[model samples]
Target chain A: DQQVKQNSPSLSVQEGRISILNCDYTNSMFDYFLWYKKYPAEGPTFLISISSIKDKNEDGRFTVFLNKSAKHLSLHIVPSQPGDSAVYFCAGTNNNAGNMLTFGGGTRLMVKP
Target chain B: GAGVSQSPRYKVAKRGRDVALRCDSISGHVTLYWYRQTLGQGSEVLTYSQSDAQRDKSGRPSGRFSAERPERSVSTLKIQRTEQGDSAVYLCASSPPPDRELAYEQYFGPGTRLTVT
Candidate 1:
């Protein structure tokens, strides 16, 4: 069984618009979530992360919202830039297992200019 | 200043062949992890090491999969009697110890794509 899942296979957004990517996880033990962005021929880089203790966390144009009751989380990118085009993966982990992360299949995001 | 790195970025192995993939983690990082990414699947943790000790191997698919960290800086993932189903991208990541101030984040390598045929 997949502990984490990203329902959408792909998403497209116009530059300067808002892009939302959603993720759901079944593991209630997960207390922290992370998002990583990957470009072709490169490794996935850490984009943003949020602790389950907080409902939301933001960094510049990127914001992550978590709804524990719903077992859902969403990543919001405002004023999306063409450079933001890449595959986004969401991961969840329990505090006890800090080194092992459970990842979603990933969502491809394309920001058109 | 360097991040984690994996060697033999692409490897094509014939079925039944044995292969070894290497990873070089950043200097001073005490924790290292290996993960496998298969088509249409999320990345799965194969193993993790701390300093020079092998900490976990529960995620390994079978006896054919084995990993070793001879030292703190380098790790090797070895496959014996490879099968076509073994094809996947192997990724390595490293991070500081949990006691450190850094959050539970890991720095990943570009990964080695293994095609077993």
Candidate 2:
């Protein structure tokens, strides 16, 4: 079963606009969440992460919001740049899971300049 | 100073042939992980290395898949009698020992694309 899911397969936005990507999870044991950005033929790179205790974490133009009650989280990139066009995958993990990361299907974000 | 490195970034194997994919983790990192990326599943953990126990192979699809970590810094994933269903991009990642109250962040290699023809 897919414990973590990203329903949106693709998204498009204009430069300088806010790009929001959403993800949902079914496993309650997951206490930590992270976002990774991947380019064609390249491995994913770490973007941002949030702990279960917090509702929101922001770094520069990127922010992550978590809603524990709904088992959902989202990543927001503001003033989106063309360089941000890539596939984004969200992952979940917990201390008891032996550091194994459960990933979503991924969302491809395209930013038009 | 380098991240994870994978060799022979691409491989093509005939059905029923055996193929070995390699991964080199960052120096001093204690954990190595293998994952396969399929069209629908994105990426799923195939296995990971552990300190005190035999490596975890629970995610491996079948007995045709096996992995060996002879040294802490290197690992190899072997697929025997490959099938077309096994065609996918296999990725490798490494991380240091995890700390409580914090998340384990893994650095990944570019991945090796294996095509079974």
Candidate 3:
């Protein structure tokens, strides 16, 4: 069973618009969530993260919101740039998940200029 | 030395062959991890080693997969009796011990693409 899930396989947004990517988790034990971006033939790079203690966290044009009760999280990119196009993966882990992360299949984000 | 380095960026092995993939973690990073990304699959943790000792391996996909870190800085994932289903990109990452109160940002290597015919 997949503990973490990203329902959308792809998303497209116009440059300067807001892009929202959603993720859901089945395990309520997860306390921390992270997002990573990957380009072709490269490893996934850490993008942003949010802890359960807070409902939201933002960095530059990127914001991550977590709804603990709903077991859902979303990543928002405002003023999306063409460079933001890549595969986005949502990952989750708990204090006791043995420090191992569970990752979603990933969502491909495309920003049109 | 500079960052995590994986050797032989690509390797092609025939079915039933044995293969070894290597990883060199950043200096002083005590936590090392191995993960695999198969087509249409998420990056799945295969094993983790802390300062040369494997702490958990429940994520290992099968008996054909084996990993070892004899030292704090280097690790190797070896596959025996390779099968066509074994093709995928193998990634290695390392981070400072979480006890250090450092961000759990794992620095990853370019990865080794294993293609089994």
i-RMS values of the candidates, in order? 1.1, 1.1, 1.4
Could you say which candidate leads in lDDT? 1
Candidate number that wins on TM-score, 1 or 3: 1
lDDT of 3 by residue, A9-105 (tens): 9999999999999999999888889999989988888899998889999999999999998999999999899999999999997767556677899
Accuracy of chain B in candidate 2 (TM-score): 0.88
The 0-to-1 C-alpha lDDT of every candidate, in the order given, reads 0.89, 0.88, 0.86
| TM of each candidate vs. truth | 0.96, 0.94, 0.94
TM-score of 1: 0.96
lDDT of 1 by residue, B1-117 (tens): 988999999999999999999999989888787889875588988877777786445455567777888877999988899999889999998887778766488889999999998
lDDT of 1 at B72: 79
RMSD (Cα, Å) for all candidates, in order, is 1.3, 1.7, 1.7
State each candidate's clash count.
0, 0, 0
DockQ category of candidate 1: medium
